[model samples]
Target chain A: MVIFGIDLVLLISALMISATPVLLAAIGEAVVEKSGVLNLGVEGMMITGAVIGFIFAVNTQTPIYGFICAAIAGALLSVMFAVLTQYIMSNQVATGLGLTMVGLGLSALIGKPYEGIKSPTLSKIEIPILSDIPVLGPMIFSHDAIVYFSVILVATVAFVISKTRIGLVLRAVGENQEAAHALGYKVVRIRFLAIMFGGATAGIGGAYISLARVPQWTEGMTAGAGWIALALVVFASWKPWRVLLGAYLFGGITVLQLNLQAIGVAIPVEILSMSPYLVTIVVLVGISLFGHHTAPGSLARPFHASQ
Target chain B: MKFKSVLSGVLLAFGFGTVAFAADVKVGFVYVGPVGDYGWTYEHNEGRLAVEEHFGDRVETIYQESVAYGADAERVINTMAMQGADLIFTTSFGYMDPTISAAKKFPNVKFEHATGFKLADNVSTYSGRFYEGRAIQGHIAGKMTKTNKIGYIGSYPIPEVVRGINSAYLHAKKVNPDVEFNIIWIYTWFDPAKEADAAKALIDQGADVILQHTDSTAPQAAAQQAGNVISFGQASDMADYKPFPRVSSIIDDWAPYYIARTQAVLDGTWESTATWDGIGPGMVSIGEITDAVPADVKAEALAMRDAIANGTYHPFTGPIKKQDGSDWLAAGETADDGTLLGMKFYVEGLTGKVPE
Candidate 1:
């Protein structure tokens, strides 16, 4: 029942729940990078989603609407990044950093009135037959709908990236923008779509924090989850399945560290505090290296087509 | 975040540059967390607002929130002083050395650092004895908890937080011999999602009563979700949870001190001082006790609160041993301000060591 003085069931359940927000954001970032763009404003977009989702959820009293609007808000914010990089040819790094600053400021402004307000938290859904199982059922099947959605989203994204024609074109664009443009693949359009998808996913990820994880609205509540999600994309080597693995690994180590601390283990708190990031980087990056995974060639490079 | 702050600092310098000339005096506030946290920073902002309202056009107040400690804090304080702030309040314990260093640089400018011990000619320190109020919550929790487990969410390993934990645990153990404490050091002053996760982890670990020394209402939301758990509001009265989770709170009132200090600066009588007040001086007032607390427990809690306020009872009254079983306080003896301020060791029954 207990592993290392922690209830294994509770630890696993907490791990899944804790990882959902970051996993969702990472999935979106993975897509964005795979299309040869890096929008560092993931933090900005996330808080925008967090505040917008929280506002709508509180006003309408429907968390689903909150998620819907949050994605729109996130994508809409990311559209700034899309427009600048695609048409204006602004430097992606500076623009992405600006977007984060803008997002934090804008969210604080809009979220002022909604501070300390609780959202309509989603109830856990226990799968009918699976809930009857002993340990794994309770661990994996009893989280809110968002948790399950994130997992399925990862699988769907992985399938699309590896199997679909759309995936080939996006990868081609990331690998060599000029080539993809010469091939008449409409490189700008594909990257635009990818950035928007990333924004939408990151937005939903931000919403998860406000609507379920914290279940309350607070200024800067997304904190640095967006940044971690951004890092997660590179560490996972832009692979969707690997992003999920990285999230769970980070989440699991964190939960384990806290649980062990609660049980009076005398491990230095500083070492344990930094363990999740350390383990996540070591495991995910180590795997990516062995698999020969690397960043997109055109990532963060400004691209424009000449007639 | 640093970029954002730097940009705002420029904007603030320009905006307040004009107002400073017309104003009789300029005052500044430096906060460790966002002003909208609805907790510690919120209360301090309320004090800042009160100063603005009380002084009207004669005084001008400016503040920068969510400022990091160390170099960033020193920079913010230095910026305010350079921009002509006559008095500035740096409201975070981590900003002690920065406050001292900044004060040295700007001798005429008055600086007050909260919950810190260091002092200089121009820098003073002030804090409330929140541990006095924690005793009442401890008694109520000991009586209310069915699980005999109390989870304390501690922010950082500072003496202010450690003292609260020790005082609360000592009282709880006095009432319930079976009571056990689980302490989690989160290392952040305000991060809602992380705070929520910590609260959930504590609940899942069998804690039924929670107390948070951090500045956020996220823990209240977490306890509310757990349905049966009880919690005390921290730094600010999180009244939304009301009769259930947030039964009582220790509210920090800094307005009067801020006003008096500002007045002292204006009057040219400002001197370096250390002020530590508790319920006795009304700086740390206890929030209302909801009916959710059993009548007997509520009465007992209130009685303890009054005794503490009246100075007849001390939360750390004697016969206590250090976690290592060494003598800490002898029978009929109470903790001195010196020992309480630098508290680093846990009492005998606590399970964990004070992290460095």
Candidate 2:
């Protein structure tokens, strides 16, 4: 019974750890899509952040600076997307895809030397009074600052989107960019900021993997987490809290399957290993059938003043 | 006037008499992962460094790490060829097709693909018998484990990884008849986060010993964090962690092979062929056995290594049974390359199926 209890706690902790990157990326993406821009280059941005963060952290032996550098790298890469799509009037989808490709190539080139070397891990923040609580202490309070930051970000984003005027304008741009443009709202600028914000968050997400989760950079380490975040934006119906719930839900599935295999569950390892993705797809299809009413009016479409 | 023209012509001929030598031999390396990964790529880079160190003036080495084994690989190879590389080494199994195609495109350049079988006249294949190292580690794990449950973190379901798991399990079972091997396929060669998660999961399930075919120190770190789990280094010597983790390691010594191959090219005797070296050729080396191991266990492991090296014993000798208890190898028979290369299932002692 004691072993089972420990296993359960470990599994939950694993879920939280796995969900941190996705949550950070998805929430930022939520804000981006909320502001009327769909950046398909989240994966690319995350990978770029991963390599840059790894290089910075490895060189300086400071994980905090690594994260900051990662955010900046992600933001810089996003600016390229912003310039092409917002300024030059290129197709947003094409620009975003191009950004991913460029980011992938650039990260590959830059990360060449830093591969395989472990980085300094982020220090954990043990919540003082709450950490002493029996089951939740180690699982929740004993996590690194990133986990708590993600939770706070989710709450802040949820509150901002539902209750604030700036979020109202962002939503207005997403709902009807032409109308927002007519109102002197500067739709392109708002969307650009949204995209940059998303990029920055995705950067943190990527760094979370490199600096905290894995604490090392490997080629293609993001491993479709960016895509999962993209899916999550839709799955959450563009709501912040839902995004958090969805990320953790998916994270739980991922952790559970591995734990199930570990506990010698009477199932094929391959099937268990694949179950998380399968479950995500199934839930996605189910949600699609049920109709996600909160989807952005101009989700994937590029918004142009002339259009 | 005729004398003046003769003098001018002789002066012009003297100016044109100076000649220049050919450029240095350019060698390019395409790695599947980063050079610092402390595993497969790290070992390969060590070999690259060795080549540079030996033929500093005669060779110019250039490498691009983390080249994926698909269209990107073809592009990188083409780029290297265009850059005037005389030899290219694509160091991954997935690079087999791309390497072959690139070799055909650049006939002047020699190509080497690690752990791949298909080769053209301009292309060669090379890999160390890593299973031998795994077998030795397995022997130690079997003898040392308080719980007879061994966990294997496999990178992929490919034959190379399968061979390692099977060989390790075979040796472990030989030592501890009650040993049960559990495998978790992480489906990637280099995701430390997933690798750590896998390690933790294994430890949680009462596996005191862990082995991995993936690259990175995450598994070792994970074992250390777990506070009692033991693990072996994947590709390079990781004994720095010592008694806590990195109880033993399978060091990939590609430097000698790389040096020899490059030297052959310089000497103009390079040829396309397949080379698979084992313990005998020093390709597979064991790291310093930790003091955590029982003295007797360490001695036994060394004895096994010597036997494997000296041809006195074969790890995969006959009288083995398939998982279904069918005869895999008859008595006095060793496993043939044909069987070993395509091995997918565990032997009779193993309980689980090789998931499709």
Best by TM-score: 1
> What is candidate 1's lDDT per residue for A146-197, written digit by digit as tens?
8999999999999988999988898999999999999999888989999999
In model 2, the Cα lDDT at residue B105 comes to: 92
Q: How many backbone clashes does candidate 2 have?
A: 2
Q: Candidate 1 lDDT, tens digit per residue, B314-333?
A: 99999999999999999999
Model 1 segments more than 4 A misplaced = A284-291, B1-21
Q: Where is model 1 chain A poorest over a 10-residue stretch in terms of lDDT?
A: A280-289
Which candidate achieves the best DockQ against the true structure?
Answer: 1
Candidate 2 Cα misplacement greater than 4 A, ranges: A1-6, A44-142, A216-224, A235-237, A293-307, B1-26, B57-62, B70-86, B101-109, B239-243, B266-268, B330-332
For candidate 1, the lDDT comes to: 0.90
Q: After superposition, how far is residue B82 of candidate 2 from its true place, in Å?
A: 5.7
Q: List the residue pairs that clash in candidate 1.
A: none
